[model samples]
Target: MKHPKVINLVQEPEVFYRIQNKYDRIISVLGGSMQVGQVVNSDIDLIDITRRGLPKSVVITVSLILGISMEKMSSLLHVSHRTIQRKGDDELLNVYSTEQILEIAEVISRGIEVLGTLENFTKWLHSDVRALNYSKPLDYLDTSFGTKLVKDILGRIEHGVYS
Candidate 1:
C-alpha cells in the first residue's frame, strides 16, 4: 500500500496567501489607478498578467514608494542599473524580473499596512533592524527567501512581538 505525501502548510505561505490579497489593490498600487477592464480577482488572474511581463513603470513606482533610488531598486531586483535606466517606463521586463517586482510590491503593501504609515514602513525598511542582526530590511529584498524573512518580521511587528 502507498501513502500520500504530507506537506507543512506554514512552509507554503505563497499558496496560503493566494486568496488573501485583492490583486486589484496590487494593480492599483503598481499602476497608480484602477483602469477600466483591468480587474484582477485571484492569483490565477495575476499570474496570467504577470507571465506576460509587467511594464518598467512598475519598478519606478515601487522604487518611489519605498523611498529608494533607481540604482538601489536595480540592486534589489538583481538587475543592473544601466539596464533599468536604458528602458523606457512603458517597456516590459522579462517574466523573471516581473515576478521579483511583484514580490517586492507585496512586501511593501504588507509593510505599510502593518507598520501604520508608508513613511514609517519606508523608514523601517532602510533602518537596521536589531532582530535581523542589525541589518536593514532593504538588504533582503534581493531574493525571495530574504523577502519572506522580511514579511515574517512584518508579521511579528504587527503582533507587537517587539522584534
Candidate 2:
C-alpha cells in the first residue's frame, strides 16, 4: 500500500500565500468587483500598475505624512532628486522622506514577479501622468485608515489577490 504525499504548509511563503490569496480572490470575484480571469491576470497587471503609478504615490504620500525632504525621498526611491520638483508642488518637499521611499520600494519589490529591466522600470515610472491624476489615484488616501488600505492592497497583490 502507498501513502499519499503530504504538503508542508510551513516551508514556503509563496505557496502558502498563493493558496491564501486564491481563496480570497475567489470570494472577491464572487462579490462582482472582478472577474475570474482578472484575479489570475492580476499577477501581471499588478506589476504593471505598480511600475506605472504606485511608486510615485507611495513616495508622495509617505513624504507628505512624514514631513520629509524630496532629495531624501529621491535617494531612497533611487530616483533622481529632480523627480519630486517635477511633481509641480513645492509642498512635496515637506511630505516625502528617504525612509518612506525605501519602505515602499521594499514592499513593491516583493510583488514584482517579472521584473522589467532597469530602463523599463524607469520608463514605466514616469508614464501617463494625466491618467494617474484623473484616476483620482491618490484619493484613496486621506487618513491613516486610508493608508492602511494601501498597505493592505499591496499585501493582497503580493499574495495574488486584491482584498
Candidate 3:
C-alpha cells in the first residue's frame, strides 16, 4: 500500500522565528553584524572557501547582504524570474519534491568541497556590526522573524551546508 505523502506545513511565523534563532546565534559568535564595507570581502572569502561558484544559494546571500529583492538579482543573473521566485517559494514553503531534491543533489555533488566546520557555523549567529538597522516593535514580530530566517540560512551556507 502506498503511504500518504506527508505535507510540510508552511507556518510563516514559527518557521521564520526558528530561522532567526539560528541566524542570530551565528552572528553572535562571529562578533558583529556584517557591514557594507565587509560584504565584498566576506563574499570573496566564502567563494574561495566553497569554490562552488554562484547558484540559487548565492542569490539569497546577495539579497541579504545588499538588501535587494530577488527579482533584481534574477535579472542580473539572467535566470528566469520564475526560477528565482521558485527558489524562495520553496525555501519558505519548505517543500522539496523528489525532482527538486535530485536537482539540488546534482548541483552540490558537482563540486562537493568542505561541508562547513562546526566552528564556522557558530560564527554566523552573532549581532550585525554593519547591520541593516531596520527597526521593529517587539509586539510585531513576524517581520523580524522572516529576516532572522534569511540570516540563519546565510549562516548555514557560511558553514558550507547546501541546506
Which scores greater on TM-score, model 2 or model 3?
Answer: 2
CA lDDT of every candidate: 0.72, 0.36, 0.31
The per-candidate count of clashes, in order, stands at 0, 3, 14
Best by TM-score: 1
Which is the leading candidate under lDDT? 1
Candidates in descending lDDT order: 1, 2, 3
Candidate 1: clashing pairs of residues: none
Q: In model 3, which regions exceed 4 Å deviation?
A: 1-55, 88-163
Per-residue alpha-carbon lDDT of candidate 1 for residues 10-126, written as tens digits (9 for 90 to 100) = 233233223234453355456532321245656886686678777887788778777789999899888999999999877888877888887887787687668765678889999
Name the regions of candidate 2 deviating beyond 4 angstroms.
1-42, 55-57, 65-67, 88-163
Model 3, range 102-141, lDDT digits (tens) per residue? 2222222111112232223223322232233432211111
Better of 1 and 2 by TM-score: 1
Rank by TM-score, highest first. Answer: 1, 2, 3
Error of 1 at 116 (Å): 1.0
Q: Clashing residue pairs in candidate 2, if any? A: 63-95, 63-96, 64-95
